[model samples]
Target: MGDLKILICVLIFSIKTVHSTKSKPHIVIIIADDLGWNDVGFHGSNQIPTPNMDALAYNGVILNRFYTLPQCTPSRAALLTGQYPMRYGYQGIPILAGENRFLPFQIPTLAKKLKELGYDTHLIGKWHLGQGYRNATPGAHGFDNHFGYWNGFMGYFNHEATGGNMVGLDMHHNDEPVWDTRGQYATDLITEKSEEVIKGHNESKPLFLIVSHLAVHTGKGGVDLEVKDIAENNKKFGYIQDERRRMYAGMTDELDKSVGDTIKALAEKRILDNTIIVFFSDNGAPTIGSALLDNTGSNWPLRGQKFTVFDGGVRTVAMIYSEQLQNKGTINNELIHITDLMPTLYYAAGGDVASLGKIDGINQWLTITKSEKSQRSEALINIDEARNVSALLTDGGRYKLINGSTVFSEVDGDFYGETGRDDSNPEYNTDDILHSSVNILLRGNLTQEKILNLRKQMELKSCRKSTIDHDSCRYNSVCLFDLFEDPCETTNIANKFPEVTERMKSKLEKYWSEVKVQRKGFLDPNANPVYYNNTWYPWLEDTRCHVGDLRTILLS
Candidate 1:
């Protein structure tokens, strides 16, 4: 009788524990800025040690086929609204600081969607959506609190951004400039703030937190490579010969620690067991010679850099961690887009996907957690009419149709390295980066055996150079590649596979026809930070003239 009672009690407790932790898991996303494909340890980059990210990735599921826009702002917009940036005219170029352009007020962000479900939502860093108007701020976008910059790139120490040829303070605690912490390093500051938020959260309500870090992304102007503690940073990355690369390595290390620290906070708070954590870069690194922000991170063996439609710019290092996942520590090659995040996480939070309305995103919760077949078959990479640049992904992403010059001149079609065109010894020098997931739960030979099998089955050949000429690619031309065969997109197969190119073109046209073109925002003179006590603020709010007129001008 006593044994029977004890067994019943144990079973009841187990059921309760499972239900509490798995059903209403806290959703967290850590967004790394301008991180390269080969920047992570799991991606086989021995240059920078990212053990924290590696440990989490090894414990979780690594997203092998994740895709995003070639730029940060558009990707962020896609993530927030669960729709293609082309729908709102954000496909062309990122939102420039001091521009009147912003995300349309009609669309609800991921924060808003979760907030509707009674989650305590917060955005801890980098709100690049637009902050010209109060309505466009993160607070108006559904975050209960916003502690970060509004522009694209800013100084890591000073928290100042140079836009419209003028530099000004950009950090904020909601709408006000965070002047007091001017000299502080943004990576450390952002991490501390995230830890603070997590520690203080009420466990009764599910938390939706986005830590959009500024680490690994080069800062504005002269202070390009921002390191937290110079002495400590130098000591760790002493093996790196070049000063620039060494600085970048240090920045990456800080980001790795940030990840560990954040996970630690959650564990300490006892919410980690019930938390669903997703981490990925906003876009690929710029590398040495790329005209896109001139960062020092490397995307070696993957052609092109940031602001290009190539895999180096689109595909990112990504992973998801959760105790609730049925198959942890695996690689998922699902056809996922940045837009998928909103619906995927919404469904994970027990919200109805139907409530999200007619967004372009498909709910990928099951595809991620249960290892179910990817429900999505195609993704519209982008249709940037402004830059006359675009690319279309089709046939379940086995093929990609490129319609514009992927800014290949800067990235050099066929020329690639950590040193850009130098073609020196590159990182991840292997022919392919094998899908990097080894279930650490297995012991000894089983782990090694599984790793070997995984390497063979999931190997992806990232070509170093191409036979095709790219002179035509410098103009508005077409290129098609079977991404499965040539993941680096070296060979332009438009002529060889004319029918496939035509089909992909037709699919792109359909999406292009449906685009609701967004007007580019002009640099408002009033937006000069010099006007607002040398701090970046919503200058339009203070204007006595008609706000409608400015918006109408932009629309016209």
Candidate 2:
């Protein structure tokens, strides 16, 4: 015990901390659903204007190599638990609506850890982790308050979700069905709710809020895309010819509004200077010709789409904005995975990172704030035995290996997006997209010219086009590439680098062997909302415990 205490002190004082606030730094995580690499303005997309997101990125450490699981559930599981979802087996795929899978209650979540330090934890939208069993809900996982749907995606206005045609109203405030706010756009409601939480927060206790948004994700059924003020959106995005893409632009615009509004609320509460706002997409966009949920967001210049292990799917747009960092307004190309969030934020909130027992995440608090070397080297992109696919990012992200490719890989492997928008790809140069607000929002340390040069220096440099054969790969195939030179993943070097490929394959096998839990989500008739008062509610009995005989004593 004495040794542990001394070690904790050593770790705490080993490097300079971000800030020493009167209160613990407020932690806010803003998630964008199915937002693609090319979807945001910061990522060099001119098709849509994301001035607010760009402004925040310009001010913060723009994450040049942020990696996530190529799907929703696994990525989220990693972030919350600080462990790869594969250990307890939620990594293979997303929980389809009405599926009986949930992250095991035994695993302590990020909210639970923060709660241990007296944080007021709240989840404002999209709790897709679990819903069938009460023990699997957000309340059971440690969030003090949860407001939103339990399904993967829902109608922005109606809030009706569908899982293989099992459709019903999904909006809920805690465990109860909510109906009063029907016909309201989800983006507006989500933004409003987040602002309300910030405004109403006691502030005596540090705030740990997760604004898990539903924006930019395709909504339910045929009316999949919902935007607030479509008439106004059409005029704003009339330049983009595709109707669906135009609607998507409007949805993305709404998402930016959420980001801007949340930051404003934090500033208004006098916590902006002491707040750490983490923003990133849960996964890459499901572009046209992708395997599932074909939303119109683009991952152009990055090969493949959602669910594929290519850079487009796993390598996502991410940034960390905080007034705490001394190193500001530059891109950090360190190897960072979604799982790192747990220890990173927990440490930032003053929790002992050493006490976060047996997690896959590496503590990067000092690295990000001080521009030191990242603690992680290799990252498991994904290992889904169900999909018969797996991938690994190894050699400090210099090499990548993908085995058992999905059928849609060939189709999605091609760089996808409207060519008209690609003329002045933001990667080409930063002449047009820089908003004037960047200088003001950047905490005043960096001049506009210095910030621009930093942006250029850290930008993802485009390589000479490699010929990508669309018809070559079929069904499943093992492919390897040197990711340092090939971020787009156009060439497969598996044969050229046999030794590297085998080593990575061995690493993946070890992780798969460590997995002790696996759950598959399947359609069920009983899960339909008609049986549960026309709303999705818990139906399964709690599987959190087993029956045991009571202890007894007999007197002579």
Top-TM-score candidate index: 2
Candidate 1's displacement at residue 264, Å, is 0.4
For model 2, where is the 10-residue window of minimal lDDT? 547-556
**Displacement of the residue 82 alpha carbon in candidate 2, Å:** 1.0
Off by over 4 Å in 1: 1-19, 407-409, 419-462, 465-468, 544-556
TM-score of each: 0.87, 0.89
Candidate 2 lDDT for residue 253: 83
lDDT of 2 by residue, 1-556 (tens): 5574355335433434233565698899999998888876666556777877877887788888899998898899999999988888887778878898888999999999999999999999999998888889999999999889898889988899888778888898888889898999998888888898998988678899999999888886624787877889888877777888889989988888778778767765666778899999988888775347778888777877788777878888799988788777778889999999999999999999889898899898888898999878999888777667778888778888887544355354566655334543233234332432332333445445764676455444374275775542234677888888877777778888899889988998898788765775688766767666567777575321111211111111
Candidate 1: tens digits of C-alpha lDDT, residues 1-556: 5574355334433432223644577989999999988777666556776757766775677888889999898999999999998887777677777888888888888999899988999999998988888998999999999899999888988889877687789999998777898888888899999999999998878999999998888896624897867788777776667788888888888898798778767765767768889999988888756356767777776766788887888888889988778877688988898899999999999899999899999998889888999888899887777666778788778998887756446554543445322223234322122211112211112243443344344434345454757554444788898887888777888999999999988998898788877686777767877666678888777553232344334435
- Candidate 1 lDDT at 547 equals 23
Candidate 1 local Cα displacement, residue 534, angstroms? 1.2
C-alpha RMSD by candidate, in order: 7.3, 9.6
Q: lDDT of all predictions, in order shown?
A: 0.77, 0.78
